[model samples]
Target chain A: MRVNRPKDGDPISVALNAQERHVTFDASRGAEAPPELVQLLTPEGERVEHPAYDIDLTPEEVRGLYRDLVLVRRVDMEAVALQRQGELGIWASLLGQEAAQIGSGRALTDADMAFPTYREHGVAWCRGVDPVNLLGLFRGVNHGGWDPAEHNFHLYTIVIGSQTLHAVGYAMGIQRDGADAATIVYFGDGATSQGDVNESFIWASVFNAPVVFFCQNNQWAISEPLEKQSRIPLYRRASGFGFPGIRVDGNDVFACLAVTRQALKNAREGQGPTLIEAFTYRMGAHTTSDDPTRYRVAGELEAWKLKDPIERVKAYMFKNQLADQDFFDSIEAEAADLGRDVRKRCLEMPDPHPLEIFEHVYSEPHALLTEEREQYAAYLASFEGGER
Target chain B: MTTLTLAKAINEGLRTAMEDDSKVLIMGEDVGKLGGVFRVTDGLQKDFGESRVIDTPLAESGIIGTAIGLALRGYRPVCEIQFDGFVFPAADQIITQLAKMPLRSLGKIKLPVVVRIPCGGGIGAVEHHSESPEAYFTHTGGLRVVACSNPVDGYHMIQQAIRCDDPVIFFEPKRRYWDKAEVERGAAPLAFDRAQIVRPGTDVTVLTYGPMVKTCLEAAAAVEQDGRSLEVIDLRSLNPLDTEMVFESVRRTGRCVVAHEAPVFSGLGAELAARITEACFYSLEAPVLRAGGFSTPYPPSRLEDHYLPDLDRVLDAVDRTFAF
Candidate 1:
């Protein structure tokens, strides 16, 4: 007798088959056509409504966000110019991702902490880190110039996706302390594929730790596009880890602020991790050393220019009559001063002493470290005109 | 004075450290409700509460990565890797992040993290469970590596490692966990970096640490019966090497044999032999002989005894030095 067997898909097989389907942003349909994005404002500086996230910013607060965007851009431009002038070894310019960084960075309370990647200059501005202090890393003077604990922002982690785990752990610590603090971690779309990031998702979900994963999906991770990293939307990947995921218009400052504020609120209120995919584009090369022209088309950049993160905020400020020409002129003058000040400070940055390399290998005195220091000192003295 | 096994001593040490400081924590896989695979963290969770003794998911990298974060939050974290072989998954966090974080931050942050790994072979356990991966950590600059061969050392070394500001890789010999000795619980903590001569002699110097310390001690006893007095030095710290003690012992004996459970090629033995030869060239009775496992993956339980350095193997290397 032939037994009838039901042909049903197992959860694992179904998930794997679904993952095989390709997910990409269709340039032909344009950036505005992407579905399920919780956008509070459009590229044309028009206000929109979202059922989940909403914000009512005062005229003064709106102007402050605009100033932040413009000055962050100015600092980024100065860093790029400094790199070109050989004042810095390299600079990771956050040209188009300003709103994504500032919005999320500004949403945090004093109790909240942030773990950032190396390309978070805008977030550093929001965190009150001096722009010149950031130049020390790119200028090869120090790994990170300022104290991370003082600013509640950790030092920049260069190894991609590693900081996410640290953020979850810190969040766990907050839970242990019975505090209402939340933790936010910044990474790019490329970091989604990293094991540490995925592990962080699992740890946060299982522990129900308060954390917000803010990923700036800037369309390009170095040379690889979003298509190369994921077959599904990066936010959708969060659902598999048993958490809510949201996408926002990274170019719209209003949308970013509203979404991040809600996410941080949810985290502080004992909600587990939330993944916010800031759908933006990298408007410049990956870094000062990268040549994006070799990999991307100029037309793509032209298309994204209509959705400039800083320009939209500026348009909103002008359309709403929040500031007059005097306000604009003062901001421009302030930006110019900032640029000149950063350049001067970057050039005046003193080189660290050669022996400083052995200063902090260990917090305690190690016999091996002492021996190596002595050996290195002797070797340096052996050089012509070199002294120990 | 009370007698305690090495495993129990370590547990007591952890309990004491946690009692001393409210900021100290213990986190790892199976460390909580399950107590731990070897029961080294037994009853810790019941006493300290789940927040202090955490039972993490079965992810080695996550355990270490989070420990670094907790350390940054001004907490002293002691992480336990279930076995020696499982430490590889967390190598990036340990070697790249935990090890170099202080130096990378230029001393702006201090990571007081202790990664406790139960290493070496002797028990008929599965393959990955028994390995001596200390050399990989010792070679890394920003990490402090130490091992415990006996109960008293285990008791003090663990607390010392937790109190140290630097990241320390504390290797506990799993095979000797059950071995007991009388310990003075109120005695001052021993310096975690120095080597100690457990059994002194004048004819030959046998250098070993962790699990192999007992094997070398047995070999020393056997060689004494054969009218050969053998000096045994337990190298408590692998990174620092305790070169002064090693050099002094070798200078007195004029013959040396380094034994360990790890493979001979590029192992801790190789570094000790090279440094000893360079320092005591004129004091050499024979080229420094090494008794250790073959340069291969840790074999199956059936073949581990053959691969591991035992009493016979140590004596054979000692005899070879005499032949030279």
Candidate 2:
């Protein structure tokens, strides 16, 4: 039954209709796992080695990863609070997937590029983007705040599966330039259903483009479940496009780091694309606007809380005697300061002036725009009250 | 001056752009070995090699989406969308991503990507083959939309579009691909955004573009013996129109008629009529008239002759401007 797949439609029905095979939706997992997961650290903080993927991080590096996971969580918490306080229009919280972002983000070489979905605040932290720069976008002060070339990280792409094609194109450009560097693009399980993402897969395959498709399957896309996207595990979909795929324990930073490093290396070596499905869960509401209570049970949340991503890293450090009380306390203090700084900076972001709408619409001098701007400015000046 | 067909002119223009910039690439379906279905990229792969001239898969969204990425990576990728109707499949990339990315970047980056589309219907072809979907892109702010009516404009404007710092939607009339014209390669060419006075007259100012330019000029000659002088103007660029040239002609004639091969309702012709009325309101002899397709899907090709604007319809529209 597993060898001979039926047609797709209602993934659960298709998956169940296949004879003698069971399709189960684990509280945190998407599809039934036929492919073994690469896990370097268990939820209980025990350090384990995968047969195919392994990493030997120095104690200092593990502490840094721990610090990253904590600070990014703090940032996300502050953003959520800001939205509730009416300081931001909305915020998409990356509450549960820190290890997946940081581990994969850090694996990128300085020469490598990353195309990320909007929820990659943790990856932005890894890329050295100022925490304050991210707030500008949420504050509605700018669409994109930081220069991509400055960090080798492209601006957050909001359209699902759109950036994947750009990532492939950039990889194709790399091939043309004969560059050894590779590119990695981040998306959700929901984006796998988009034609652009599927087209990107074909493009990467045929051109032998150096691009890694990193899918952080947080189990939910707004309100829809993973069954709506695929019957097979998302990583397994890559083999149909003629590339290697693997599932990694997204909550385990060591496993994520090891798996991503190998995938990127394979791409740079001209082995073509690799799809790394980082299995994780979205522990928080999708955004400030969504209500998880509408669809899911509280017990699922309680179950996932036991396997918190940051807790596992902290436990691993403690068991190995890698970090002590002072180190953990300092990380906590640093996160607190970052949270306060981001809020202050976000409030201080000036609202763009009305005339600024005409700015940056084009690189060349547009006559029509110039005429419209002048006319609008004259009209505004005529408003008996100035600056209205 | 060398005479060449519109397709060959664009092919030569692409060759010129490639020769000048090593970073320029041509990517689309069948662009490499097939030189495109219209042969607009003929022999380009032979000269530039596979690295620069790429044959993409049969995915419009992929061609355009990847072109955006290639542009971000510092390569000027001139993408071909095969036909006009097929552009809708890639419209998401064009409108949301390609048109908005540079603006979203706040001028920190420039997308020099040029999207080449074969537009307008006169060719006897099936659906999704012949269409004039220019108004959609023209309405998009960050893009520059231009169409070439003849070979020289096709040659010079294509090369110029490649050199611009902005993303350009270049429409090459499919029906006029074999039309021949003299191209003065070394002479200073007018900018692609400027309009041209194809035929000068004192009575009526008729504005048209792309495939309809030839028909409008033919209408002008048809009206000459009837003692009604008509001036035909080809608006090469649609978005930031050359209103200076248009206003000059409209003011002198005191009459205006907008013509195209798109739908008459809410189409590019409507936008032109509004702009002309605003600028030449007092100089007008009548409300700007329009002559083009009806509000319907481009009908079966057997009826395309009735659907597309021809000489009589243009003359009638021009004659109506004298009514007021």
Candidate 3:
């Protein structure tokens, strides 16, 4: 299909554009899973080998990855259901991109740090942050629900491409501290358009900062497709910035794990930055508020489900007799319990007192806040019975 | 006691801050080798080495964005936006990220990052080089905004801002760079946010900051011939404006005038005028008058004299306040 962005044009041009602007979603190309895609596990339960990147996973480890992928997806589904039921303001589902998040997320050593764009729920799970903490931000109870220093997982940045520079800066700090640790930042295909991301690429390269740029090219950034974000492949774009760029099979959990571990190792070894383009698909809408039906083809979702990050792992486990029906049943029961617990805890979360607005704006006391807080308290008191 | 130019004092202050805290880093374009356009960070890289004194690629947003990350990693990064007008490129980082990062983290983090921008007109520099954009920052919450007018404050205030746990937008008047004054190096510095009454008087209270502090002081001396005493208050801190101190002066003087190189329309002067009028309403004998640049953008260097607030323009405001 010809690339046609919706535009109001002159009569002659409008006539030329009208037919192609009638965009029919075509996932028939199977959504362009790259030929160069580094895959360890194939779609139908086969363990494949890659020349450069490969990991020897024990059956238990493979099952463990499957558990992570399943649980993360389950948590994401719970959040989505909560959003539909008005329990959450919004939820950015990590549906098809679970392996991309969990694999890369699990690759980080305890000393390394992470900076995430708002959708890295799987990453947050790997970082030891309570899944409920993520809900608080979605529930509007707080801006961010956990301390970055506590988890080494910085708060989810809502602004597109803003966190990439922060990641590089954190890496530079680690470099200065003489620590053998790296920083990983999660952004999407669309964020590559932002000047800050490009600048971060320059910074990461020039400073020889120990950082990894993990871009999950999940096919769509809200409504725009991959073609809108870049002309060249997202990974290859890193070459111009003087860094090694690799395209990993984002759905294959093993590839994500192996590639990320190698990238982080290279970073800690003082080899500067690596851009890992995790080739995957957004199986669901961007957020609860988004409608993929409006801009995407339905068959695209179907095509990606075949290469689902969790299913392939499950298939591999079953083929290898990694577990019996009891194991699958147990995981399902655990997922159900987690969903119920999340819903209950989210509903129980209380609204902060109005006066809490005066808090945290400044770490130190300011005369303006002192007066504003006091005067606001008195004003509230002056009301009938303080409040209704 | 030693006499140093405002630029030199800031350079010394930065040097002192770097010595005091190993985590404090200085990053900007040309800050490492060139020592900055106005030499405010002169000789810093030579002493602190390249690690602490960083000459980043010429991108304002990148400079601040990385600084935020550094601050998150427990490093105090002082970023420099090469010029006043260039800060808008990083406004997303400064406004969306730097200003709100602390509140977003619910005080779990402290960003002791300082963004230094050389501001104001009168250096005969080109457009964008001479603009006072303090109002934009002061209007934003969660960011502490400050400007130092003279060498003493320049020396001590830079250190104070560095020590401040909040993200501070520190403005240095470009015109006042060469202005020299005595700085008692070892003396304990005044608090960062306190407003000082530079010259005491009982006539009209003229409140100003940064570049205009000197102008207001000059206006006070110029109006002294008319047997009028103008109380000049240099509001060192703009965001948590020392309005209480201004109220004290304005209540006594009964008239007020606010001056700055920034445009009079919706400038920091407007906020000062409104606050002073509101608090000292009954005590104020006249409405607060503002003397500042025109609403237009900072004009060419040749036309800056007319656009910027001069001693005569300030005196005119002081005279108008009396007439009221």
Candidate 4:
């Protein structure tokens, strides 16, 4: 009854060597994108039309989108500076994916809920979460600074693809309640390889849960490129799970907004889940802790720089004459004010009470927690007299 | 009072909780139609309707991940993992997400979710079915782990777990599911976090939980013929262990024997032994002895009788404690 179990092999030697040549980021050859991508605005600020998704924005609406893009970029820039200045521990900079986040975030109604990954500061801004509150996590003062229930936005989930299943579950609850409100969950291309994400797609498809799976394909998951994760396009994985999958020019704010809005509408109208793959790139390191120079070439960044999310929006504003010079100056001033306020507030943020660690472990009181708290207090008091 | 098996009592408790709160829902694999592999959720979907009692796809991570979502939406979800060995697939959700979300939110939100797992070996079941993985949940910080020994406790604890605001890991002893006891249907049971002295004795204290409670109790009864009285305590809650009760029993008996189905290496017994030694060091007449499964993977069904702790093993540990 001896069983001959398979032995482990080198993944680099086995999968990489055989498939490396065939795996290409170019979407021209029967890949997941290029054909199904719904782009309302090109990289050069040219306006276009889509058959399934479109939006007729007023001058004010167009200016509002532009302001959102600039402000979010400002917040990201300030946070990066704060990290470099040693005010914060680490930061996940959303340098290139501003349009993808702001577009989908702004599309949500007051009733729609969003479950975000840790790098969704743009979405947080659109949800009206104070940018300073976002610093609490990076500053090592708190895990989350705002109440999720207050803004219908959940705390940022750091674990890769874990939030997708929760989004689907929340959507199922909304279905059971017979509510028209929908749920949107954001993740990265790296998270598409996680088991929880695939499981969520299956559950959402079967239960017809009202959720939007928004994957910002930022090309690199740390050191591994998109070629390492999937051979086909990520959105194509959605159709296999019995749902409509769409790709959008993530750098184009117009396209992201329109596609996301349509997806939410489909969910609210009981059409089930939709996977919107935002074809974008991470313009910076994975985080302040990472060094992209170790793995990626400088040319890749240069290529993505020409298709900058904020630059395209700014170009569109200039070409369409949607906003005046006064409006642009006011926005710059507002962004400066936000950055200064965030910096001051972040520096002044008080550390939480030492005993706060034991507070939320359980909702009800327990004997063990009481004992542990008492022990910790005594341990802390032992050092009180030594400082003198 | 009604005589019911432990499984039936849990079913009744679930029904009562669902009836009491409209937000209470049951979701798991084969939970709606097949009534669960252990039949613990039998006939629940029929009475509660399809919306409340959901039959989920065969994905453990999906079950728990969605359960967290439901909790966020103001629903008390009681998720059933079919077997103890099957809970690993959902470990990320259970340990990382569900357990840490409330703490991460800084008390702004609470996940009122109960994950019910049928655990421990003894029914002659094969791999991925019989296992005592309670230590994993108990080791996690934000979860409250509890195990029931009999029908009465099962009935009351299942309801209390559902009502609990924090996420609870409810470990049901699979071998004892069919064990019957008289349950007061409408009456209150013991507190969810308290331990009970199932049998009073003065010679030695026998501490155990879940499926091992029955074995320890039987061992205590058998030792009575040899003119030795063994005190037995059922530690219902594992995380917030009733240390006071354990210390009190050990002080009177002056000896302790901890028994469980999990491996002895860093098992619940190790923690209990350390705490008991710290609290009742002067009162102890002998060192704490543990009777548990070997430090190996759960063996096949044919060899489970030897793998799982039994009355003979419990008595052997008690004798060793006295020999010291």
Write candidate 3's Cα lDDT for B1-324 as tens digits.
999999999999999999999999999999988999888888999999999999999999999999999998889999998899999999999999999988889899899999999999898988789989999999899999999999999999999999999999999998899999999999988788999999999988888999999988988998788899988999999989888899999999999999988889998888887888789999999899899999898899999889988999998888898787
C-alpha TM-score for every candidate: 0.95, 0.96, 0.96, 0.97
List the RMSD of every prediction in angstroms.
Answer: 4.1, 4.0, 3.9, 3.3
- What is the C-alpha lDDT profile of model 4 across B1-324, one tens digit per residue? 999999999999999999999999999999998899889999999998989999999999999999999999999999999999999999999999999998898888899999999999888887989999999888999999999989999999999999999999999999999999999987867899999999999999999999999988889889899999999999999989999899999999999999999999999999999999999999999999999999999999999999888999999999898797
Candidate 2, B245-284: lDDT as tens digits: 9999999998888999999999988887888898888998
Clashing pairs for predicted structure model 1, backbone only:
none
Please list the residue runs of candidate 3 whose C-alpha ends up more than 4 Å from where it truly belongs after superposition. Answer: A1-35
Q: Against the unseen true structure, what C-alpha lDDT does each candidate score?
A: 0.90, 0.91, 0.91, 0.92
Q: What is the alpha-carbon lDDT for the whole of candidate 2? A: 0.91
lDDT of 4 by residue, A177-276 (tens): 8897999999999999999999999999999999999999998899988877887888888989999998898888889999999999999999999999
Candidate 3: the clashing residue pairs are none
Tens digit of lDDT per residue, candidate 3, span A61-85? Answer: 8778888888889889999999999
Flag regions of model 2 displaced more than 4 Å. Answer: A1-33
- Ten residues in sequence with the least summed lDDT for candidate 3 chain B: B269-278
Better of 1 and 4 by TM-score: 4
- Candidates, DockQ: 0.74, 0.83, 0.84, 0.85
Question: For each of the candidates, what fraction of the native contacts does it recover?
Answer: 0.61, 0.73, 0.81, 0.87
